[model samples]
Target: MQSILKQKIIGIDFSDYSIELLCIEKGFWKPKIYAYSRCILPPGVLFDGAIQYPAALSGILKKMMLSAVPNFMKNGLCVFSLPDSQVFFHEFIMPAALGGKSLRQAILHEVRTKFPMKFDDLYYDFIVSGKNHDTQNILFFAAPDYILEKYIQTLLDAGLTPIAIDVESMSIGRSLLNSRDRRKDVLIADIGSRYTNIIVYNNYEVSGIHIIKEGGEKSTNRISEQLCIPKAEAEVIKKQIGLSFHGQESEVSEIVADDMKEIIREIKKIIQYYLHRKKITIDTIVLTGGCVLSPGVQKFFQSHFWQEVEVRNPFDKLRVQKNDEKNKRNVLFSNVIGLALRGLHTYPHLRGVNLLQKARSHS
Candidate 1:
């Protein structure tokens, strides 16, 4: 008998204190989510994006799988994300004369020499973002192989399989571009627990990506430490009060304002750099992930940057069942949703990289 084909794709979002899983099967346009699970990490299990308690995480994953998806379990390929801090992204210009085979060879050679770590020590990918008069601009991304291997092992220990590894920023970009028009340049900002990632796409290709060392969790930590309150309570206040409150003066508000200033400063620098390099103003700033949900976050950008900033809804143009409306509104699940949507044709060029790897292995 012919072996059963595995078409389902799973996405795991291992955040600071929670592990989220979104499993989906390809439909006509968007993916149909088959299973979704979120497990909060035990106290002291993980802190500030570091794995302080691997055993706890593994236990959580195992229990979640048993409870969430029982019958279809198989190793089950999953698309995993790497923290913004653990990865490096750079864009460089390639000689315009190097086209086709020559261009491919040059990129492979450069990846080996320019990377701080040995080629085998890191998983690297490159995207060509069109050519200038004498050079072709390319975006290069590298992440430690060991870090990714550990995540893969974590899944394995929990009886799951990791099939693809992607940068969180790119995954967010995938979801945004998939729902919106692809003909325009866009920027996607993924606000995670402790860090925010910015990815700029020109013509649907990654042109630039950067990570800033601030996010919702930082705001919560600052408030908790300054006010001497519990973390849970601080988080609640941060999300509820947000940055727009006009009453109740305290040190926590000052700290939050400082953090916002730093975040906005870096964002302006990155946006300016993109404008200079691309010679085109960004069409839209799409915010996703957990942090952007806070009240006035969109207003913060609008008042400061003078650009049209819109919160990204992964299901904005997609269809889902009536029961899934609430789940569909969670922007924090955008990366996982996009990862699952990889099974669709929305990201065909990304698939080309896998084929290129195969050809290299044969050669």
Candidate 2:
């Protein structure tokens, strides 16, 4: 049987504020980007990870897919990501003696007991890493059934096949971590328009994830309120000035500083929790998502964290076209590129957890 990992697929990321789509040709050494595009979502289309207007979203997606890639309709296989707020993650260790059906049963029982929601209302999946003596370490995710169905139905309405679904954190991890960095402990802070997703990766597997309800949108709103300007104008100024703390932008930067500090504090808490539980220090911190486009944000993180903090570019390894404008906005596509990388299967360690088969099995 042909492995699904080897198949060519498009990757889609649905955020509260925007939708990103990427299609790439999987190569042996590096993946080549064929096309990519981003579409801003109108307000009320998606809120807190739920699709409030499925038909409207589908219509927008249909237009985006048609315009972004020439052969999107013919090659409809796609893997998509759900927002971090809609997904729940947990890690546990089960007896290595359990195998196959027994392991599945054990995991299901544990998931049902540990998670507050009933199994019937949720779709869950897991990946087992290596064993430590007699116990196998496992990372699993559960998302509400209604949300999953909404995504699947939206894709269907857009004339695309939804092959698999994953969370944003996994996609970010795949896009940011290279082979050398996979085995090292790392922290990823993905600051999007409406949410900041903090993910911890230990020894090539996701160990922890947390979603902060603050992000670039909050910063923009602060800038707007402080400058007494319209939001659209504030957005432009925010990107142009961006926490530089100098000259004309200093006042705007100061206004957004509080939110940034809160985000950093949350990151610290997540790191401390991981360190206390695992006894391993995080080797590096990778920052991605739209907020990373802020002019001095990377330096801000580096100064505060006192660790090797770097902004992630999902397209760094891919072949670049001459004067490609999309390359400059790599941070915006990090999650979608990571989802596309999941399709390439160049790095098995970075492949995301696909819940499609698990969802079907439950049905």
Q: Pick the candidate with the highest TM-score.
A: 2
Model 1's C-alpha root-mean-square deviation from the true structure amounts to 3.7
Q: Which regions of candidate 2 fall more than 4 Å away from where they truly are?
A: 1-7, 69-75, 346-351, 359-363
Please give, for residues 137-255, the per-residue lDDT of candidate 2 as tens digits.
77778888898998899888888887778778888887888887866888999887778998888887777778888888887887888779999999898888788999876887876
Model 1: residue 316 alpha-carbon error in angstroms? 2.5
Instruction: List clash counts for every candidate, in order.
Output: 0, 0
Q: Residues 123-242, candidate 1: write the lDDT tens digits.
A: 766666777788888666676666666676777888776655666777766667763446777778777777888888777777777888887777788889888999899988877667
For candidate 1, report its TM-score: 0.85
**TM-score list, all predictions:** 0.85, 0.91
- What's model 2's lDDT at 132? 74
Model 2: residue 166 alpha-carbon error in angstroms: 1.2
